[model samples]
Target: MKPGRPRMKNDEKQNLLSAGDNRHRRTEQEEDEELLSESTKTTNVCVRFDDSPSGLGKTLQTISLLGYMKHYRNIPGPHMVLVPKSTLYNWMNEFKRWVPSLRAVCLIGSREQRNALIRDVLLPGEWDVCVTSYEMLIIEKAVFKKFNWRYLVIDEAHRIKNEKSKLSEIVREFKTTNRLLLTGTPLQNNLHELWALLNFLLPDVFNSSEDFDSWFDTNNCLGDTKLVERLHTVLRPFLLRRIKADVEKSLLPKKEIKMYVGLSKMQREW
Candidate 1:
């Protein structure tokens, strides 16, 4: 594996990943470091991993590493991590487990409590990372948009697939130099959804959804295997997708079994 940035201290690197019972597998470590490096190079990144073999824990650790790298480089931060309400605490726990040295504050609880956090902790930049829910983001957009964030990491990023949803609109307003999107399911239903992600990531390159759709349509009609290759080439730099079957040899492939049964005459009558 390529070495991590030289500025990263040995202890910091160790802290960036889990140890003990929660230690990352070899592949996980490689992915985490590679992603950390990629974040520096790309403005937007989409990391897609299968739910079975890939753990959000590893992804969260990678995010912590990114925050640390930014701090080390003297970049402005107080990075924002927006996740679903259900995963708010999980993200906090992941940070504590993987990179306890980095201070993280979860903007949850009552309105007054959240407001107090914003006033006392967030505005002053007392924390290295801020973990909030999409709901909270909309409710507190005024406060969040004011900050010049170094990195904005969105978990379950498919939440913004609509591109016009209130949550998506509000998040897009947050001024950040870099963005990272994490999702187990990246493209759910249509190509437009994929376009939504790309537009969010590289607005300059993918400025118009109509243009993106037209390019695909034109290529698909003249396809002689070139369409698939062209799509892959475009996505290669900004997207990373991995499934259990491809990465984990120990995992057994899923199997299906069929059985035939006859219903009783009484059951049929009923």
Candidate 2:
């Protein structure tokens, strides 16, 4: 929808998308061009906060996330928003109203387009950003396997809160340089439940659930801030956390809330 993004014909996009019969080529330049066009723009992050379940929490958290991403750090790869089927477009609308410069691709496609796009990202600096549902990622496994991800932002990441689930296994399978898990509820089930999510973000940050549990038990009822901050060693490579009170006290006063739902694009240079 933004200017300069090349438009493609429906039949052409459809034909390219429907490559059930032909596997020899990408079917069109725009398909490949979109990937190169997107990955080059901006790094996106997966974000979460402690108070996210409160009113205005999701929006405020997402707003803070955009600000933190833009001003505090510019991670080197495009972000992929992985959420439930319901939350995918909520993410799209947030990006639309908040960070208009970002370009996004919904991982929704005919079997062919999804596979082709993933192959395209194998080249460095392709697709400024991509968003996909957890189901879609599993569906597009062949494509997802082809490239190394600059960052993987798992929204409602609790979907893989269990380390052994097939979804969690698939997420761990990707070659990701950075990882962020976003969820409102941090201590779901118990502190031990947090381990699987943290482990995916930083392998063995706790080493074992019992290890953190023991440390918490021994330290006068205080958990290991040292082990938590020790996360800096691995997590700094992947995570950033901020609270809404950190910024936007004024902009958030009764902001209008609307949800725009759609599976969505790519754009140009800096």
Candidate 3:
């Protein structure tokens, strides 16, 4: 008779299944889940905010949730997350906290160090998410573009407002079907800057910068009452904006009271 392969113990098999089931379950807060749903439905999403009411934690959570959801759905990913150098560890920590089941690798440090990671980890597609700084992206465009990214999430997206910048130009080359921009300050300056962001998010839709500029200029010159309304209409579909006061009821506005007291002789002497 042929020898039979050894079977796993009942307890061991149950434990393995339990772990897999936990990873598949949805584990995001309701608001974050709702945001993820909206984000997944659209190709281009702008997460606008005046200030992070939840100290930017919710935004990170939403990103993590999306990554996890994609994994659970069996979507192919080497999702790219671009952030400022200072927040590299923060993003790594966020993924650890929210979705430990999915593997994440941060590509930073010296050129050799990053290259080693690219050879060992990134090229193999072992990681579910790849987090890197904008500087690294500019330097490693060729390597980054080699992958078919599922999603490209940009934090502090205002950095790309100037389309001519090396960073902006380089990132636009990445192959991603979905793009998400996270910014507390979405509109810092002119309308052209806004057009730059829209173009980055939805290149096919906002293909012509000249056309976008002409429309706004024509409307502005006429002093049309519909100018504000028209801008809102265009942005409403793709943008999700939230403020501190709206999301956090416990956070009350700071109150300042002025009081004057004369200094004692001993205090002045000290």
lDDT of 3 by residue, 135-212 (tens): 999888888876656678899999999998999888887656567888877484378899999988887688799998
* C-alpha-based local distance difference test score of model 1: 0.69
Better of 1 and 2 by lDDT: 1
lDDT of each: 0.69, 0.59, 0.71
**Cα lDDT of model 2 by residue, 77-177, tens digit:** 35556778887777777767766655555677687876676555433334445678888988876666544455577877778877888888887776455
Candidate 2, superposed: residue stretches over 4 Å from native:
1-76, 109-126, 217-270
Task: For candidate 1, write residues 140-246 as lDDT tens digits.
Answer: 88887666565788888899999899887777766555778888774733667888888787665777999778767643635546776787788888876766565
Q: Who wins the lDDT comparison?
A: 3
Q: Residue 18 in candidate 2 has what lDDT?
A: 80
lDDT of 3: 0.71
TM-score of each model, in listed order? 0.70, 0.54, 0.70
Task: Give the range of the ten consecutive residues with the poorest summed lDDT in model 1.
Answer: 1-10
Backbone clashes counted, model 2 = 7
Off by over 4 Å in 3: 1-58, 218-224, 253-270
